[model samples]
Target: MRRLSGVTIDCAEPAVLAGFWSALLDRPVSAEHARPDWATVGSRFDPAPRLTFQRVPEPKRGKVRLHLDVEVDDIDEARARIEELGGRWTGERHDYPGEGVVLGMTDPEGHEFCVVQYF
Candidate 1:
């Protein structure tokens, strides 16, 4: 059986970004890890997946080949929260009409991702 383990993001400061995501998801940082170069946040109660932040030397450029889609109850509220967490709202794409709404955004390190709301 195939199972998803974790998603890792490359950033200059692993702990900082990890903390931001931890607050966004309301998950506690993993106690098993003791490395400054990497940080993870998640737990068995939620049981979704761990978000791992890794240290990288260079900054990201152009478009990201892979990104995440976060589901939210309110798109506007989610966008506001992302901004308050040091993320920037790039733009919104409404191609699917009534199917869903997607807002393109980048983290502090410029890694592009999308916030999607489906009804």
Candidate 2:
């Protein structure tokens, strides 16, 4: 059997980025792994794969080829909270009428992700 371990995000400040994700996901940043150059959310014991942030030398240059999709019960509320946590709404929204809504968003450092609300 095979399983996924974690997703590593490259950034300039691991701790700060980790903090943002921790707040957004309502998961505690692992105290054991928190550091200037690296930080993580979730642990081996958690069912979900960990979210790891690592310091990188270069700034992000272009649109991310892949991104996270965060599911929420209410997209508007989620958007407000995400902004409070230092994330930004990209002004790109998609609505599927009877299905759901998807909003483009970016983390504090501009890494893209999506906030989704399903009917």
Candidate 3:
């Protein structure tokens, strides 16, 4: 069986990025890492997926090949909260009516992620 372990994001400041993601996910930062160059955040439950932030010297230049898909109870409310947390809403797709909605957003560092809602 295959299971997701964690996802790493490149940033100039690992602690700062990790704080943002930790707040968004409502989880605590990892205790394993005690360095400013690298930080991880996730829950203590089963199948916990860590969001690792690593320090990089240069800024992101191209499009990201991978992005996160977060499940939210309400799409509109989640989008608003994300925006307040330094996330920018890119767009939304409404293909399946009353089923689900996908809102594209970017992090403070311009990493694209999606917020999905299912009814």
Candidate 4:
């Protein structure tokens, strides 16, 4: 069986983007894996797959089709914290009576992600 390795994100600034993810995930950026054009957060020894960032010449142009969903204990708190980290709420929210709540947000660079809270 093949195991999923890690997810790599393309961004204009690898280290900066990695910093955002590192803080959000509470994972340290791997100094050993950092370079001028690349940066990584989390370690191979960790059970979760590491996140890597690669430098790209072009800026993000349209809406991202694939986005990350960050599960949190409190959606409002998480949204506020994300905004403190240079992210912003996108005014998109959904709620299910007994299921959960999902709020769309964007990173400093405008990458979209969701903050989810389940009841």
- TM-scores for every candidate against the unseen true structure: 0.88, 0.94, 0.88, 0.94
Question: In angstroms, how far off is 14's CA in candidate 4?
Answer: 1.3
Off by over 4 Å in 3: 43-46
lDDT of 2 by residue, 1-114 (tens): 467768999999898898899999999899656567889988857888889999989999999899999999999999999999999999999999999999999999999999
How big is the positional error of residue 16 in model 3, measured in Å on the Cα after superposition?
A: 1.6
Candidate with the greatest TM-score versus the true structure: 2
Model 2: ten consecutive residues of lowest lDDT: 29-38
Residue by residue across 1-119, what tens digits does model 4's lDDT show?
Answer: 55766888889888888888889989999975757999998876778888888888998999978988999999999999999988999999999899999999998889999999999
- Stretches of candidate 4 above 4 Å error? none
User: What is the number of residue pairs that collide in model 2?
Assistant: 0
TM-score of 2: 0.94
The alpha-carbon lDDT assigned to residue 104 of candidate 2 equals: 98
Which candidate, 2 or 3, has the higher lDDT? 2
Model 1 CA deviation exceeding 4 Å by range: 43-46
In angstroms, the error of model 4 at 23 is 1.1
| Residue 25 alpha-carbon offset, candidate 1, angstroms | 1.7
RMSD of 3: 2.0
